[model samples]
Target: MKNLLYILVLGLFIYSCSSTKNRDFNKKEITANANDTVRIANDSLEYEIIVIEPGFNLFINSIAKPRGYHSQSYLENKNIFLVQEYNSRVNQPFNYNPNLYIQAINYDNFVDYGYEVNYMLYNYFVFFSREYNQRFSVPTRI
Candidate 1:
């Protein structure tokens, strides 16, 4: 009787562990989907900006200003300043979190990357700053 009880308990423990592992795998898939990637590109200008972060899609849809709210020039100006500040941080990884400031953004003021590209880039910087609790020298108000 004692031996039978031990065997049953051991089997239940193994089953529970397997179930937990499966649940964790499912959770990871959901999390991956949530961490969306947004790409903004202008073929004629040959410029592209890719933003990969969690909750950014939600932020842009719900929190950010409408697409045509700001003029193209305004978006470009904000993007230039924000990109400069962000790239500075990326260069000095010791001063900033390396994981957060992953790569330098190549944004040229002379290039006309269109209204959509500029708007998305500007909003991305805003999202990144707010999400990571970072502050730029220039204003990041939406």
Candidate 2:
């Protein structure tokens, strides 16, 4: 009985130690991913966009087109269309997956958010669509 008790305690201790190591590794990974954010702030206009989705930074760097590939007007047009569709989905949770369309994006056509803002927004929409397997009414150009 004494030997069995010792073996059981030892096994529990080893199991706990291994689980703690895995938890520590996961914490470090989450911390690293927390830095993966895309932020664009227009202080003059008081307009800002912060994307906290994981893998977006990597997507933009590796998969997305280089900056200036699309003209500002082109980006704006694409963003406008995509935003409308996205917001529509957000509005109708019953129709669309609530998990996928969590919040509506406020995008005004009248506001000139500059090339960089539009560019990032457009790429973000593209990334979101691809990541979630959500398709827009109009086909998204890669």
Candidate 3:
């Protein structure tokens, strides 16, 4: 009983002392204007993107399919890497607010592996931009 009381008090103390700087993700906007454009330069990918009218559709009706649902063990650590990579590579957090037509992706449970998922996401953004002519800029990074 005494230990439990101590633990509860310690927990409250730590919680109260923790910094709140990163807690308000609500301040960030997930949606962008059709005309909004961003330049991305990162180790995973480099590209320029225009937000484009009507936004984007993430899932293309191709024969290819996403990896089946993932188990928690397989997702460990890789989830953090994927989020970090996704956040870094996307001009905005597609993980947070996917573009216009893009479907809500199950980022946590969707992939069999990390690299493939990132590759697919980066290309899909490019594909959406090119196919729609909604976004244009140039050069290349792969």
When sorted by TM-score, best at the front, the candidate numbers are 2, 1, 3
List lDDT for all candidates, in order: 0.84, 0.88, 0.44
TM-score of 1: 0.77
Query: Which candidate would rank higher by lDDT, 2 or 3?
Result: 2
Runs with alpha carbons beyond 4 Å of true place in candidate 1: 1-19, 24-27, 30-35, 139-142
Which lDDT tens digits does candidate 2 get at residues 63-137? 999998989988888888889999998999999999888888999999999998998898998898899887888
lDDT of 1 by residue, 89-137 (tens): 9999999999998888888888778898888888888888888888889
Report the candidate with higher TM-score, 1 versus 3: 1
Report the Cα lDDT for residue 54, model 1. Answer: 77
The residue-by-residue lDDT of candidate 3 on 20-135, one tens digit each, is 65576544433443233332334443322223333333333342244444333443444444444444435455443445444333344443334444444544544554665544
Per-residue lDDT, model 3, residue 17, is 80
Better of 1 and 2 by lDDT: 2
Q: Model 1: clashing residue pairs?
A: none
Error of 3 at 31 (Å): 35
